[model samples]
Target: MEYRKIFYNVSEKDMSFEDVIDRLKTFITADPRSEYVLSVGTDSHVHAKDTKFITAIHLHRKGKGAWGCLQNTFINRQINSIHEKISIETSLSQEVAYHFTSDYLVELSELLIPFSDEGADLTFEIHLDIGRKGVTKDLIQEMTGRVLAMGVEAKIKPDSYTAFGYANRYTR
Candidate 1:
């Protein structure tokens, strides 16, 4: 098993979550490996409106013992959040929770990368907070374009029920 982390110091004033997603897609596609797991991190600032910057980490594993590797990778990148908790929910419904110091967020974000030798199937989950409605719309548009270009099937969720119904699931 292998783990990789990547960090981006996003200029909150200029870049939105959509821009980060586009760059992430490019980074992933540029690699030759077919399987990976990605986790993205964004800080929730107390004083300012959520900036939505992210750190993405990928875990690669092969064959029968892959789950253990994935779990370890997740543990290594865990961060302690005042408002949120990082927990591992296993297939059997067992959950393990831990608290981490604030500095680990950057460390975890810097770990996102291709674990080319692990030989397992690839999966990804991105965690981000979109602060405004207009920016969210733009971000969704950009995300749609990148996902389509990659030829990967995805499911997109919006804040409300009636706004957009799973745009990634059905192509227009």
Candidate 2:
């Protein structure tokens, strides 16, 4: 439950789910006019006997910059298959996105109503680490489809900064 602020300045420390949700709410409530794009992504690093998974949530405020937080977990198992690794990463990201959608997003939506007429559209994106240029290329479709089935948009590879940038940075 560690919190790593990637785009904005904030003290990094372990945070509870409630703390994370409150931080996210603060970002939205502070700027009602800004359109928000929320995204989740995960990256993993496998060691000798364990795998470290880092997941991130990016709250992008349209043209204005964005702020994000990350959490990591360590699994005491060797992940040797690329497909399994990518699937796990996508799963982790999806789970976090689901939490935001099911819980925090509802609260944010109420705040967004007054701004609806002003053209504020919320976009929740699931960023995947797979792309068409690497070995993960073969997995792009399946992973993207999984996200789509969840009724959310998906971004892969070159477009998935949350996974490759923030999450990857802390996956040690």
Query: Mind giving the per-residue lDDT tens digits that candidate 2 earns over 1-172?
Result: 3323322224656666677777777877777678888889999999999999888888888888887888777789989899999999999888887777676666766666354575465678999988889799999889999999988899987999889987888887
Error of 1 at 154 (Å): 19
Score every model by TM-score: 0.25, 0.86
Query: Which one wins on lDDT?
Result: 2
Error of 2 at 43 (Å): 0.7
- Candidate 2 off by > 4 Å: 1-10, 113-119
Instruction: Kindly provide the TM-score of model 2 when superposed on the true structure, using C-alpha atoms.
Output: 0.86
Off by over 4 Å in 1: 1-13, 42-120, 125-172
lDDT of 1: 0.29
Q: For all the candidates, what are their Cα RMSDs to the real structure? A: 17.0, 3.8
- Clash pairs of candidate 2? none
